[model samples]
Target: MTEDDETALSRPQRRLLRRIYNGRTEPIVVEGLAFLTYKEASRYLLTLTEEAREAAYQEMKRQAG
Candidate 1:
């Protein structure tokens, strides 16, 4: 209810406006759909069978070196 209380809230609120998500980069954007989660994406892309998905999952984990 006081100016001091209002000013204190404004000070911290100013930071909320200044904070922008700057972690984006050109490499990821150029890759196209890099942000898309691989776990779900692969399921839609590969419809061979659950066995194939399991094999692909194993292969992905193996190749992640």
Candidate 2:
């Protein structure tokens, strides 16, 4: 991914990356969406449809404020 793509990820997305890559195995939930595994969630966050990505972004924004 480009630097701009990396920069575009939300705070929660970064946290998820850390959690997944650092060997955290628990599922994660965001905005009512349940991720059964970090890899699964990471995949969704990185390569899914725009609607899913936007939902994640909005959820992160909501949590931040």
Candidate number of the best lDDT: 2
lDDT of 1 by residue, 1-65 (tens): 34553333234432331231123222111113332233233433244465654554444334332
Window of ten residues with lowest summed lDDT in model 1: 21-30
What pairs collide in candidate 2?
A: none
Q: What are the lDDT scores of the predictions, listed in order?
A: 0.34, 0.59
RMSD vs true structure, all candidates: 17.6, 5.5
Which one is best on TM-score? Answer: 2
Model 2, 1-65: lDDT tens digits are 56565555667767755555455444456757666554555556777567878787456434434
Candidate 1 global TM-score: 0.32
